[model samples]
Target chain A: MKSDIILAGVGGQGILSIATALGEAALADNLLIKQAETHGMSQRGGAVYSHMRISDRPISSDLIPGGAADLILSVEPMESLRYLPYLSETGYLVTNITPFVNIPNYPDIEKVMEEIRKLPRFIAIDADAIAKEVGSSRASNMVMLGAASPFIDIEFSKIEAGIRTIFGRKGEEVVNLNLEALRRGRQFAEENR
Target chain B: MQKHLFLGVEAIGQGAIDGGMSGVYSYPGTPSTEITEFIQENPLAEERNIHRTWTANEKTALETALGMSYAGKRAMSCMKHVGLNVAADVFVNAAMTGVNGGLIVTVADDPSMHSSQNEQDSRFYGKFAMVPVLEPSSQQEAYDMARDGFALSEQTKVPVMLRITTRLAHSRAGVARKEVLPENQLSLPADPRQFILLPAIARRKYKGLLESQNLFLKLSEESIYNRYEEGAEKSLGIIACGIAYNYLMEHYPNGTCPYPVVKISQYPLPENYINRLDQECDEILVLEEGAPMVEEMLKGFFAKGTPIKGRLDGTLPRDGELNPDLIAKALGKQMFSGYAIPEVVANRPPALCMGCGHQDAYVAMNEVLADYSKGRVFSDIGCYTLGALPPYETIFSCVDMGASITMAKGAADAGLIPAVAMIGDSTFAHSGITGLLDAVNEKSSITVVISDNESISMTGGQDSSAFGKIESICIGLGVDPAHIHTIVPLKKNHEEMVRLFREEFAYNGVSVIIPRRECIQRASSRKRNKK
Candidate 1:
């Protein structure tokens, strides 16, 4: 079955890279993929989301319905809740437990986390800690994707292929390090299960 | 296998690839920005050797595309609908010149005024320019028309306008890809005299463009873009054009909407489709966006229909946008009556983009120029015009495109001094250049601050026309280059900007200050990338 998945987050968390990997993975599995983004605000510590809809059949309405999404893939906690209404009641939320509370006017991190701790159906991971352990804070979203991906219907092989597409022309080490992060996330999820 | 998954904006770019456009010149504006951004980000553009660049503003983007066409390469320019007004001068004139290669201009009309100053229809541009226009109902059609727009422009020897609403521009769809046709790479005109706008040749070409109605109508009849979709003809027919067709079909799938529909994507008022639609149906309801262009034209060509309902004639509100719910209401279906509609007087206006340079500029202007009447601020169109809001309700009138500068000049002539005109660098190049020239030539006393943010920040951070040359131009225009001050629009330096304004106010003749800074949006974008 084809479903539309929207990944929204602030930039620098690799949101575009995630959308690219997801689109490639879906395409590898032979599903139709349509993804669009708004970059004007993405670069400015502002909200950014990639609307990705994958379907087995042709479709209209490029934007996902306000609250009919099957899964909400978010890199940050607040971003997950930002698109919560788009998720179906039974929809799973795959997100990181880290707080990126760097908004200009509001600078209190713990205050922001207190509010975000209340969302339902959350599969939270200390992505920032996991990414730091992996030698790159930039990989936090990838670690979260690694943790939450088991709940998705997409195959691991497809994600691997998609990851290769993103690593494009880079050294084997660069690709292997990210692969290790994905493995760590998957291993943690299975062991916890 | 060609992938079907593509964004509406990506599909538009791919359509440009298929449509054989040699270049896509645009400045980023919300909704419409992704087209150029995607073109740059994607690998296909480079593989095809397509020339896609972010121009300074709508006018410069249009002019650049026009230059490409003059060189005999199919070219396209794109922007949000309000940008049409910025490019209207060159845009309206481009119709007269026509082109050797195809020229297509796409405007993403932000209906409901989302990410816009006003929700205006680009259809008016088609009627104003006398050019054939096309509006796509879906992402598939967005791609299809983008490719075909070139053919239509070339066949008619006039520029083509492709219009899409915010939904279509920002939406995503599974667009099946077609093989890219090699573009028609043409050479320069054998005679350069043809395009040089000298009165002798331009007069003749202008007449030729006016007499092209028959050819335009012929092309309209043969249009592959606009067609009559045959369905069961009933007492009621649906005339859904552009994205309205997409929403209407979604609202009534399969047998529910068995009534015949005239899906007029291409324009010049497709008479054949309208004639068939009019002959079969007893009543017609026009479901089009941004003004009653089609509805008005249909009445002009044929008058026999009952209860023709649309944006005009009180069928729908004459202002704002049209959606399926409105269409449903017009078709005698009940719609959700929401919270009592807020009255216009009671409605609040837009504010600055939280941490925007425009806000800083407005704060400085309000503080320094409090002596002048609060309503006397001469403002140009941009996010800076948001100063007309609370906290800094400094702008008086924001009429036309670049009238902010000249409107202040008129005030200066009538005994207003120490007056200020704030125009963006991109807009200064667009139309403010000539206005500044007039002020300098006639010796009108005005202090104009060319807020040189190095880009057009409003329509989504397109390049600035005076990107590196604002100072040179101001000096060339006979204003002392010393008065051309630069300041980072930070609140801490409001005094510096304010002091520069104070000094320029004393200067009797034309004075310009170049407040140089990168648009906060673009600057923040660069900062995020480094992380």
Candidate 2:
């Protein structure tokens, strides 16, 4: 029952928050979760990622093997391609269309997106556009997460409940916005899928 | 409890909360930054009235935590391994000036130079300081030991160090929650003479430290961490540590590992375990990260170790880190060669992100220094130092934090004047101030380029110490207002910035050119959010 899920993205992208939400959702669904986060150079436009593993059974390991992830939640398209190796054979890939291509040597967006589309399982979404229309682009990651929720082992309400308390601790305003983000993402997924 | 999940960093912070910490003081450094960030963000911290704030750098962090400890409170200071070097002065001495309160210094070591100039072992600092060190095997242990670390310090009359490698620092495990305890009420030191570290007082304190060895050895024997795991009847005996212990078990997943292993995660190395291992197997592999300190010590204690294999024998790479395959080879097991990562063309590695102020600072330094027949730029530790690598290559020296200014002073005094001292905003506050004071008093003609990125960019965008004060610090240090010029470090303003650098290069006294700009990477993410 010891399995692994690796989530990676740049900082300021709410990648860590999305991972937190996922971890919470898994826990709420009655799973044992162990997530490790490593982000430095994240301040320096460096890539940030976390290794999350949830098991219905007791687990001993924290890290996942290459290509072992059951789901790849890509906040941005390039990140999806970058983390393609971690995807299991039957894994689902939920990605947004925004490109944060800061690295000069990296291939163009079209090339990277083309590479991601070539992968076995990928679901690309304009999560950023959805977030933009909602006037809060920071929720782009949550949008992608909501779009991917039905595919994960856990139900969406558990994720919503997790998000409620998480943002509830801050204020009622953030809770409302985050809930709206979830709804918009779910709606996007229902319509598109 | 609804089975709350946690990030490894947040878990450490949560562990601290569960372990009962009074306060956390730190300067953000990668890998270790989240420990403090989590504390600041967690609602429990606010509800429980916990304290969390970013200090100037590691020195201030150590000193502030020491101040809290002085008040008889449980305090922790965290930073990357390199930050230990900055805190070394106070850190080494804190052992002699034992505390009424408990102090735990957490250092996250970077292996393979991830966001660090070098991968220095923090355990070496523990040895140098003669302080007790604890390494946790998993996230749960990270919490347990973190709590124990404080009491252990109190028991030994010295501060304790929690040394973790990148793997352990970044890895997570199911950490069962321990009962949270109440915070230790702030109390004062009993004896006023306890902290008077003058030579007159230090001699006895040093003697006191030596006298405490018995206590250290006692803890080493009974530490909950050090374990003698029984292995299958066969091949060899292995002495594993931290993540290495995890891998040892992983390699022998079927529980048929053909070796008797003594996995240790605590300091001073239990003598009983060593004697038992000595009687047990044909060969011994001292598996550890960072240094061969254990191998060197084991050789001194146990005779020849039945042909011990590690860094000394070159069975493993003397430098860098050890992984499962490397451990397998050391155990003479078949190695799993990884998938071939194709090499790319010899292009310059990433220097600074576009619109980054550090880049403009470098560009200005290079442009102005080209005017001089001889140009020497002494660089300190920060994101700005990345200029030493790529298209910019402006800085020459990168030793420790604040090393740039002092190193520049030395070179300037020895006929290398107009020496450019390039340093970061956070670094200037950390160690740069003392060097700046040195430069001013000595009248060292060094042109100091304070690359004010408004955040500690290299260490993952923690608040920069100079967020409010940099000009006044220089002004108070006797740099004239005329000499202290500022410029916004965008690409379009490079020409004007170069003009400023040229002017500073000609100044007779210590001149500061503050190229002020928010870190592009930092601004991009947080700018949208209302603080």
The TM-score that candidate 1 achieves is 0.79
Error of 2 at B481 (Å): 3.4
Clash number for candidate 1: 6
**lDDT, residue B248, model 1:** 68
Taking chain A by itself, what TM-score does each prediction score?
0.86, 0.89
Q: How far is each candidate from the true structure, as Cα RMSD in Å?
A: 5.6, 4.3
Error (Å) of candidate 1 at residue B229 is 3.7
Residue-level lDDT of model 2, residues B1-531, one tens digit each, is 333344456567887776678889888876788789888987877888877978877888899899888998888899889888878899999999988788899988887776678898888898788888888767777877776677888888788888787766676555666777778887899998888899989999999998887778778878889978777763568888776776666566565466777778888777888788878777678888788888887674546446676788788888887765566677667533422222221122335776777776777688888877644999987777778775777778899888999999999999887887888888898889888999899888998888888887765677876777999999998877888988898888878887888877988888998988888867876965655
Per-candidate TM-scores read 0.79, 0.85
Q: Which candidate achieves the best lDDT against the true structure?
A: 2
Worst 10 residues of 1 chain B by lDDT: B339-348
